[model samples]
Target: MPELPEVEVVRAGLAPAVTGAVIVGVEVFEPRSLRRHDSASGHFADLLQSRGVLAAVRRGKFLWLPLDSGRALVVHLGMSGQVLLRSPGSDTDRHLRIRLQIEHPEHGELWVNFVDQRIFGSMAVDSMQPTRDGLTAGYSGLAGGATGADGLAGSGLGWSGLIPSQVAHIARDPLDPGFSAPLFLAALARKKTGIKRALLDQTLISGIGNIYADEALFEARVHYEQPADSLSPAKGRALLGAVRSILNRALAEGGTSFDAQYVNVNGQSGYFSHRLNTYGRQGLPCPRCGTLLVRQQFMNRSSHLCPRCQRLR
Candidate 1:
């Protein structure tokens, strides 16, 4: 699944092209992609037609297009999902599941295609509500979000509304400007789990997946199995800094796209994979120290780390 950086890259790439565009039509090649809607494809298409896309917003791995109707179209880019923007008459992708036709006065007609080879991603229409102050309102991943013309009510950005039900449980990611470091530290101090496990907990901190978690832990010289509560204030700060730095760097590089499925809106692969140090560098020499990196099973996924540098306490 795409993490913060990857999803944000797509959002940034999409916002420029899709914002202000009106939905002209929709094509659902596979109804399974709209499984989250609980309704038929006709209704899904009907709800979006003529609606203006105000902003391409994202929180962690979740992406949404805020429409003029107060409701937002929530998008989940599952493990192998790709959202590509192409010219009106371009050849369709073999895996295309959903195609959204939009009319942009300046850019002309365009097609936003959602393609998924594994059928894990889905699109759904969701209701919006206001978030209270700086804290996320309804659920966790639903916390901290992008502000725009359709912002939560009273936030100056617009109404402070948020998409409740589905995303209410996702916590704010560290990259969010509104992310509360004090709150994260307090929560970390209370967790009895491993630091990496805590990092992967969507409800605790959104967006740090296995790959970035390994990279951040390696950079901070913290073991994946280290107890979360055992981290000192300085170490916690270092880890958080590493995460923020890694995410920003990844975003700058267009995110780490090792698989062909992960790409930006232009269908271009990310170059950050070439810059990765620890995620899939097992058996290679550590960049910082002259020690062989190793891989271990973690949360059913493989974790790459330099055992010499990331020693467990």
Candidate 2:
């Protein structure tokens, strides 16, 4: 599963070309790639053809392109999915499932290819809803978004402050400027579950997975099994700060790419995997304390940590 940093890289990559680009054609080589698409709403191809992309926005792991029609094309990159941008005559990407032929005023024609080896990823055309807070729906770098014909930074539609209806349930990610730390900390102080489980709760805090959760816990020196509400306010703040730091570092490094399945639009692998302090490093020596790290079966998955450094107490 692609986490925030990985998805953000894709979103940022798409923003430059897709903003204001008109969808000239939509090709679906694999219908399963649109499993999440609602047939009752409208035909996928028909709904998108000739529609202009407003902006590429994301909240948590969910990515969406707001169309001028006020509907959004929601994209979920389940495991083994990659969105690639390429020229018309370029070498075809393997496992290509869907391709959007878009024409931009200045950039001309380009292809946005949705490639997924496992077929778990999906694309859909969905309705939109106004955000409760009336804040911008998601992050588009719109504050510093792609420049347009008028030399403006963002689309008028981008400021609509509407999010895809299909993605309404996701909470804002830590990296989102609108994510409220005081509110999140207050909520964390009320959680009855384990800290790791709480972090994995998208409804609670979005964009965290087993990988980053482990890394953040290690950084905060907090045990995965520790209760969320058990942390004092200072400790909670410290943990949140650790998450931001780790995510920023991962973003700078282009996110963790364990395999070729995870790559940016240009198909380059992120090297953050090399900087991992914990996660998938079981039995390796913990960098901070020289203790042997361990992996424990957790919620049908696995958790990596330093038994000595990340003490449950």
Candidate 3:
């Protein structure tokens, strides 16, 4: 599954092409892709046609495009989902789930194809909800789009910007400009769960998954199973810093891509996998202490760490 970096890459790639574009056509090649679509419980294609997109926003793993109709188009790239931008006469991508023919003011007509091999990914048209913080929902680019009669850039109600109702509950990612580190630290001090589990909790801090958890722990020199509440305030801060560092580096490297299923809008894979330190490098020597790195099963998944450096204590 794509995590923050991967999803952010897609979101950034889509911002320029998707924002300000009008959906002229909607074709659903696979009905399963619309499983999450509200459609007011009606026709998915009918509700979305001719809706002008304001901007693309992403909160955690959820990506949404606020529409002129006061709704949002949400996308969840499950396991092997890919959103590819292509020309009208281009070759159709395999496993294409949904395709949107959008006309951009500057870029002209283009196809936004949602391709998913596992069918776990989905597209939805959902209602909007104001964020509790009254801040812009998440990271967005090119806030350009069609204005309403009021001459507002988005839905007239878009003051502070609303997010998809489905995404309203998710916490902001570490990279979000609005993320409150002190609040997250306070919450971290309250968790009774392991650090990795706490990191994976979307309600606590969004956009982290198993892979980034291990990498952040490795950078912080903390064990994955280290108790969250047990961490000292300084250690908690360090861990959060490590989280930010790893995520930023991953984003810079275009995100970690270990297989063909994960790719950017142009179908190019990320190279961060080459820089992995602990995750998936079981039995490899630790870079710091030369101790053997190990992988252990936790929560039915695996965690890689250097036992010498990340001792549980």
C-alpha lDDT (0 to 100) for residue 19 of candidate 3: 76
**Could you give candidate 2's per-residue lDDT for residues 1-313 as a string of tens digits?**
3798899889888999999899999999999999999999889999999999988988889999989887999999987889999998777788999999999999999999999999988999999997777677788886533223223345443434778888888998999877999999999999989999999999888988888999999999999999998998998999999999988899999989998889998898888899899999998999999999999999999999999998987
Could you give me the TM-score of model 3 versus the true structure?
0.93
Q: Candidate 2: deviation at residue 200, Å?
A: 1.0
Q: 1-313 in candidate 3: lDDT tens per residue?
A: 3799999999989989987899999999999899888656568787789999877888888998888888888999987889999999789899998999999999999999999999999999888887787667787753432223225654453623577878888998998878999999999999988999999999899999889999999999998888899999999999999999999999999999999888999999999999999999998899888999999999999999999999996
lDDT of each candidate versus the true structure: 0.81, 0.88, 0.87
- Which residue segments of model 1 deviate by more than 4 Å? 40-42, 132-161
Model 1 lDDT, full chain set: 0.81
Off by over 4 Å in 3: 39-41, 142-160
True lDDT of residue 255, candidate 3: 92
Clashing pairs in 3: none
Candidate closer to the true structure by TM-score (higher is better), 2 or 3: 2
Error of 3 at 281 (Å): 0.6
Candidate 1 at 84: error in angstroms?
Answer: 0.6
Q: For every model shown, what is its TM-score relative to the native structure?
A: 0.91, 0.94, 0.93
* lDDT tens readout by residue for model 1, 1-313: 4788888877788887888899999999998998777464338888898999876767778888878887778888878888999998899898999999999989989999998898889988776765544443321222344344344455554423454346666787787666789999989999989999999998888888888999999999999999999999999999999999998899889888877778988888888988889888888999999799999998888989999999988
